[model samples]
Target: MALLETLVVVFAVAVVAALAVVVKTRLFPLREGEEPREDVAEYISMMVSVFYALVLGLCLVSVWDNRATADDRVQTEASALHQTYLLADALPAAQRQPVRDAARAYAAHVVEVEWPRMAEREPLGTEGWALLDRLRTAGELTGRATLSQQIAAQEVLAQLGYVDDARRGRETAAGESLSVVLWTGLIIGGVLTVAFMFLFGLERNTTHVILVMGLSGFIAFTVLLIYQLDAPFGATLGVAPDPFTRYFPL
Candidate 1:
């Protein structure tokens, strides 16, 4: 619903800008000798358009890569936890169940609790860290044990380490967002790019209006696209919990 509202707002702004250009042109007609300056205006507009395009492209790519990385981290974390669960089977019969249960509980918490919180861009809290610590503790085999059990414990700890790293990465990604400066640049640059279209006078008034409307609409659409991708886990197009479900079904 928020995304839909953003789209509506951007579209409305674009339409209003286009209308303003039309009204301005009607109110103050271009002078008879304005043709000589058009070449210079066109060159300046072209440069501004090009620079803005480059900035937009950079922003789009950065957000897209961040989203992809967030998805990868989720998948990696789930996979490592699943491996830890399986490694538990190699431990002593008494120790195996606790490790497996801890792993399962951690995965469940992530899918059930942390995911929703991430969508709201809120911290996952200490509960998740507590669960991870439980898993680590359960996987430890410091007491007198068989050689095979010792080796299994080592592997389990390693896998837990992977899970921890991935989880940290996921948390960081969830909290990540585009900087305010970048957003300011995108918004101001978009307005300038659209406003630049008004400088050149076209042969037909309809042509001018259509040109402005199209440029404004495209600029608005690109800005909205970046906004959606800026927060990897908070947007509708965000990374999902499919990885957890796939490996550790409820």
Candidate 2:
């Protein structure tokens, strides 16, 4: 509930900030009663347009990198899990099934249970990572066995280690704080740029007004979309866990 409220607040602030640009420009004239500075205003507008373009480019690149990072983390984790599964054959007969079961169970839990909570930005329940640890330990205990089994056991342990590290990476990546800051800059930049639209005693040109408002609206909307999707695991507008789900039982 608290997180939802925070998200709402973030969203409200962004929307208001974005719309403020349109309203400040179209409805209220900031340069009322001032003499025209046509040449200076035109130059400033051109510069601001460039600024807006750069900001937009930065936002797109930032979000794209975040998505790619999350996807790569998923692939790394999945690869480890699969490798662990195959390496279970190295375990003694008594321990082989246990390790395999744990691996599959962890995958299932991630898909069916953890994924939903993560999507909602909720912390995962206990027993999820615990189960993974158990699988790792089970693999480690295969020590001093047949050489082939020992090698296999080592591979499984290595893969399990990979899974642990990848999971940690996912946690860090999913936070996506850069998006938050980018949003702040984007929205503030948009508002300030548009506010400048009405500055300094300029004669109202209908065409210029239309162009300014249209550009403002588009920039604002694109930034908002990027903000919503910045968190790859977030429910608002993020990557779905269905890909992870496929590895699970249910």
Candidate 3:
């Protein structure tokens, strides 16, 4: 629902931009004197460009931090999960395989099932979490063994904490209100910048090259910025699901 609302807002902005362009070009034709004196248009464009750069830099910083934090969280979770797995070996023979099997199954379900859905921003189902609970309960450490199990259990619990926090971070990164706004600004600024170009009476031979360069660069930078943030779990640039793979896998 929130995503849908964001889309609607963006669509509305695009519509407004299109209408503004039509009206500006058709009715308020650009003329040397009709615009402000002392190259006011140029000054405004320069200021807006500078501001846009600042905004772009800020967005990069934010996303980079978000990705870095997510990575750290996953690493922490992996460490905790590893401790729990090793502890399984110290359990009584009858309980060791059961504990390890439960952990492995939980890890596999997370990697195979939960991840792809998160990529699409879907809520993780309750079943995987239920499995985690089962893994915790399967310990069956009573009295004397309980102390050893606590050491491992505590670590696994900590890892689970990290995993949950990291998921929230990943989700937060995607739902960044400012990112959508920054993208809106970049796009609108580019259009206004380009449209202002058309208003200039440039020579026929020289205009195309400059126009192509401006549009190409704008499109490339703006697009990839958004794309890089879209997935928090898929590639090297994305959040590492390796926590599960390294410690929990069969």
TM-score per model over all chains? 0.81, 0.74, 0.71
Sorted on lDDT, highest at the top, how do the candidates line up?
A: 1, 2, 3
Report the Cα RMSD per candidate. 7.9, 8.0, 5.7
lDDT of 3: 0.66
Predicted candidate 1 versus true structure: per-residue lDDT over 1-250, tens digit per residue:
6556666776799899889979988997788876544676789788978988998998999899889999999989999999999989889888889998998899999999999999889989999999999999998985788998999999988988888899999998999888666676688788888777665654467877788788888888889889989879864789989988988899
What are the runs in model 2 whose C-alpha is more than 4 Å off?
1-36, 142-144, 179-181, 195-213
Worst 10 residues of 3 by lDDT: 170-179
Q: What stretches of model 3 exceed 4 Å from their correct place?
A: 1-38, 146-179, 206-215, 234-237
lDDT string, candidate 3, 23-127, tens digits: 988897778667445576678667866776676677667767766766676676556556667777766566678777877887787678877766665777787
lDDT by candidate, in order shown = 0.87, 0.76, 0.66
What is the C-alpha local distance difference test score of candidate 2? 0.76
